[model samples]
Target: MWKYLKIVLALCGFILNTMILHTNPINDVTNLISIIEKLRPLHKKLGKPGPHDWLAHHHEPGQTFQEYYKSNPMTPRGKRCVIYIQPLGEFTQVQRRIVVLTSDFMSRFYNLQVKVQKDIPLSVIPNKARRRHPEWGVEQILTSYILNDILKPKLPADAAAYIALTISDLWPGRGWNFVFGQASLRERVGVWSIYRNGNPAESENSFRLCLLRTIKTAVHEIGHMFSMSHCVKYECCMCGSNHREEADRRPLWFCPECMAKVCWATCSDPVDRYQILAEFCEEHGFNNEKEFYKKSIAKLES
Candidate 1:
């Protein structure tokens, strides 16, 4: 039964990838294979997804390095070198600090400059775009409106991608309760809410946890903007997430396959990137995360 299920899932993934990616087939993939091979031993293989996990529910074929290269994926180059973060609403001092830290970390992660834009008042979201959840009664903001109407129009000419960060809760549309965030591959615009990241002012641990979550979401969304698909091959930041618990379970680092894409997309040096990432994690008390990055760097340098 499990073997048959695996075949069915593989077929579903192939079909979905063909439909959505739509890039010319790649050939002479030797270099790509070499890169994946070199980094493979440094990463962990993904276990089967749980019954309610993202992969269990949605079939997605992970993108290969050559496929991404041939897809005319958005790379940071020329004028499109800056990542712009648009502030959507007011935030507490701690929340504001989280936003600032997120921007800084994003700059280092993608090796692209990041700029936080002037704050856009929450009042800009009209009654039509705001809601109160019927059951939970939590105030929510419409994600589509922000992506299409707000950020798209105002996206900077020099932006590699424009992202919005907000304190207000987010709901994608009808039939959903809430979302941590959402992004557009074609539009170069995305938005995420830190409302669900937990209040940072509560305690030191909570603050660190909130920062880690925010950084993960920020970088993951931007990865999508680069036309990188969910990673099916390993436990990775690019893997699709089904819920908060599942997302938290995923690491803050990219798997070998996804790392290759990021390195290629940003034209970054893998060793240097790992070193800086480790330093950031260590400074913020993410000891385990710090050690993992350090190990990756050592393996790469060796």
Candidate 2:
């Protein structure tokens, strides 16, 4: 089953790549390049990574706007533009609210329509695909099972990406412990666990933290689905993280280069995008992030 699934995924990637190559360049390429240049100084360069940081453990060449365009990266095109979110399993009132807000943020982030599907019960998972952590005694469902057996089979025809949002803990396989999320760039299927994102019912601060983490992971994985490599150029949300501290340290907004990629891919106006993002941050009390987006708008418009 695994082998067959792998072959199918590879074939899907090849077809997608072929489509990208034949697709015409985005009409606003020059405008996006200008926007990147305009906002360049406002973005900060990524510094040396700590020993436990993602970059320290994994070497990524990083993707620049030019490289991304030249490679004919995937974008939401034709009927495959909507991002679909499938909730798998139960959620507390707080967690459910967080998921709703995250979906709204994703819509604004990508400038695409987002649909939250009805819940798919956890009963679908079988015994072979679940385990209890030997050391921690925590229950976790197999991420591969969710990605392959569940998400891939039901992926909506109009979905550019179909992601499962779950409150259950997730494990990729035996060698690993737990993953916050996993995504198949080729298959456009992903599953994320909010079990480790902290209990949102704790306090207002905790709720905000949980929401921030959820938003970060959602956009990050979806960004991967768009053929975006990890951002090594700046302290952008696209930058990879190995742990919670590193993820928390990263900003919610993309850097100038990455911002351009999102704009070009979505055919969004940079100023308008920043404005909408800033409003979301303000509404959600993300004061710091709000200020950053506002500043980005200023830089671009200046």
Candidate 3:
């Protein structure tokens, strides 16, 4: 009777433990789904695309929060959690300042540690990969070389994503005028250029614009590294842009669905993430963006 009783108690404990393990993840998903619903009204659905808009050409079926969660998207895990930014070339004082601010925003955005590695000279790009644009006359470096030869070789074992930031212009290859950025999602590597983001030294407004553009590019590429597809459902940072006009029109914050993805991927609390982003936007004079983040926080908390 004693032996039978002990076995029954042990079995009960195992069943209880198993139930708890399953319960927690279900609770997490349920909470995330609730948050997504709460924030839905705050986001604008993607409008009809103009002639040159990204959606006009790309025709991608956007991913919903449910779909993204089901896809087993790549996420930072264990020791491989830091996002490293490698500076690929020279930057002006203003550009360097932009880089620092962008890094801070990225850390807050992803809830990950972001370290800016030391500068790497542009000379590392071979002559064959360098070209002077035939029609535009702007000097550009091949993006493939940077991702394949430079960043991939130096990719840290603990890096969730390794990205190169450069002031120089970037081109993927022949027939392309320029690319704002490029990345390998599965491999967790990317490169972006601030060449067209505008001259920060020109004026205060110019500096702000340049900083906003840089932050957008960095977060967008990093979003891809996390297996997020271009957002076609809303006016979001994850949405692809085919031109500077389209890019400038995009908000610095992710839409409701994409926001859910970010929070889920990083295992971040929605309220805390919004609060930090609001503070960052306020400090940087992004008044409009700050208000949006504040609204998100209020919605989540309520």
Candidate 4:
């Protein structure tokens, strides 16, 4: 377990253990779904995508740069192939994969129509705040929010939600893991991680945790869009984030109460979704997904 950190740190250049939440008997899945819905942007408020937009991104780990481009086109080359360089910051090969994978999961489960483009070039914005922020990077949109915040009060909320919708990280506020951008009536979300130490390489469980959290971040932020606040249902996804530590300590399960709302947003039933989600979790090795889901079911006493 300890050795794995070397790889993660070497890759992203940073590695740290955030809080970990343990799920007790699931009581209110409905409460969870409600929170995810609240994080979404107004459906119509989203920006339109260009045909040239990339579907998503993934940096090939343990593969040569040439090999990486081969599987993933270096330009708007293939069907959904769009090469991303450091549009506003640098992304190691592995970290790149994290973005692509997380984006794909959200895009698929949510049936989102947004494109996943990568490597926009760190110099694109030319803003000092973006270029120099230690917590945030050039790629993340927080710098833009800072500039746009005064002109609008709720700009930060929307911006945080948007990034939360698509990228990885909880970005609750101060020490919030995620970075966000806001506009007139909508917000944009982005991820910004600084590499200083090293990254995880082994421990598939760790990687899966990161991936699962990515999905939660998407759902949690989306909850903000739907007018729901954090769920107080025993450390659930919508519990609201004041920092990354709290975000990590959150269990990625929904209570019965929240599940009711998620079904409405995606237009599906919680029972049905949980059944499918369990299998998905098994395929992906997410025990918590399966464990917490049991809480939503009406158990037959022995």
Candidate 5:
């Protein structure tokens, strides 16, 4: 049964990859394996994890978390994260994707790095960013074209950085927050895209907010690289947002519990992650989300 279940997880991962145009190098994965093991021993002793155990992780389930654990499929450390981002040029729609990425990272406390690579023309990619951020006109988002293509991976100079690339049409998501990364902490990470925001003859502030959201989205997705989850304390930027309005509702911070979870997830210190995020946010002026959003709209319109 345990072996069969492992097959299920692997198959599921493969199917998901095909659907999203995403890939997991360790087609033979690990994170899920290790987690199941560590928890299984105690799970049986304590009845096992809640019904929600298989809830968001896979979108599908097979045998059981405990069953897999007893079987001992893999180790504690592995990169189970794998994200596929569609293009949105550089506006609100793009921001939505990033938000989804960030929220997912916080929820799991996993390191999922996101990056951008030019792909199809913004015009070709649809534009949901405009619908949400009407303030930004369409002209700005309807940037020049490349083709109906995937983003080319661009590795950063720093050894600490890596890259992944892809491009999808507008309105990308069937889940709350998902990401792409190697199961092993040792692997370098990255993701990027060129998605369209909307289709407006004129540009506006709403368009700019759309752009701001895209930046936020990238930041959120990249946060996954560190293995962090949604903050329970204060409104977490990692918290899921279904609409543009909700996107503005959360603050960017990992709750205390989530912070602890990330530490365990990445085998790193939580404070260290927090410090990195805080500093990055401050540097990019992500602290002024509202202002930035508003500015995005204004900028695009001009």
Candidate 6:
């Protein structure tokens, strides 16, 4: 009798952990499913990768909604609803403007409060963590230090994710030449650089491109901080990239699976998110992005 009772109790525990853990209430899940279905047509189904694309170079199994839920991904709630951005170096006037715009966009993207902390000088980076590229000669800072030592320790009590944005280039450790950015998902900390985002002062087009690239990387890294992994199922913003060309090939929007993760985590309304994004893109003359968002809204409403 004791052995039979123990087996029954174990089965009940397993069922609850798999089905109920990390999921919203039954009604909320139903509503999210309905929203995802309506917004489906606005997003293209990913077909095949090009010769030099991320999927061609890397093998990722991709994370589905079920996998994400089982992972117990972090969500914004109560006091932990703020996203914080820490500036680590000097910025040109245009670069500064890009930072300002990105902060504003982030707030709307995740439906959370975004706070830009006071600027911290690059001088704070120790000499050991600073290096010059062997051939390119461009100076680079260590990304791990910023993530582990700086942002993690300084993370705010109310922060959902703490991100550091710097104008300087970054390299993760000793293996690579340089990296665009790096983030630790479990730690809820990350860092990115605008150095390779293109020179915003070059031309009007350059400025716009720089801004778009910066926003893409910023949000992508933040997505990781939410425990979202590289998107293998679609050509979404959550897709991993090995190089600039590959990254640029992906759309600035989330695919259905990845979109569900974000909306679930943030408790955001998909229609409202699309409307705000459309408005922001339109105001910034991001016509292509703006049109996509508008179409997403249309699909949801229709």
lDDT for each candidate structure: 0.84, 0.87, 0.89, 0.39, 0.37, 0.84
Candidate of highest TM-score: 3
TM-score (C-alpha, index-matched) for candidate 6: 0.88
Candidate 1 local distance difference test against the native: 0.84
Superior candidate under lDDT, 1 versus 3: 3
Candidate number that wins on TM-score, 3 or 6:
3
Leading candidate by lDDT: 3
lDDT of 6 by residue, 1-302 (tens): 99999989878875665444235453166676777678766677677887866678778888986688668787665457899999999877888899999998898888899999989999999998899999999999999889987898899998989999999999987768777778887888999889888999999999988988899899999999998889886678888877888777778788877887887788777888889988899999899999988888778777
- Model 3 residue 243 distance off true place after TM-score fit, in angstroms: 0.7
Models, CA RMSD each: 11.5, 6.3, 6.8, 20.0, 15.4, 6.8
Model 6 CA lDDT for position 131: 92
The superposed Cα distance between candidate 4 and the true structure at residue 29, in angstroms, equals 15
Residue-level lDDT for 259 in candidate 3? 85
TM-score of each: 0.87, 0.89, 0.90, 0.50, 0.35, 0.88
Q: What is the lDDT of residue 252 in candidate 2?
A: 95
* Candidate 5 TM-score, true structure as reference: 0.35
Q: After superposing candidate 4, which stretches have Cα over 4 Å from the reference?
A: 1-90, 107-115, 131-202, 294-302
Q: If candidate 1 were superposed on the true structure by all CA atoms, what would the RMSD be?
A: 11.5
lDDT string, candidate 5, 1-302, tens digits: 99999999978876674434212322212443443233322111212223433223333222232332234232123234433343333444645444454434333324444333343344543553223324433222111121112222332332232333233322223332222111112233434333333332135554444444544444444444443333222344444444445554444433333333333333443334444554444444456643433332233234
Clashing pairs in 3: none
Expressed as tens digits, the lDDT of each residue in 15-111 for candidate 2 is: 8854663342542667777878888887889999999898998899999988886776767876688999999998888899998999999999998
| lDDT value, candidate 4, whole model | 0.39
Candidates arranged by lDDT, highest first: 3, 2, 1, 6, 4, 5
Per-residue C-alpha lDDT of model 3 across residues 200-268, encoded as one tens digit per residue: 999999999999999999999999989899999889999999899999999999998898888878877
- As a whole number from 0 to 100, the lDDT of residue 169 in candidate 1 is 94
Candidate 6: worst-modelled 10 consecutive residues by lDDT: 18-27
Model 4: per-residue Cα lDDT over 147-207, one tens digit each:
2432233222212223312222222234434442212212333333322112434566666
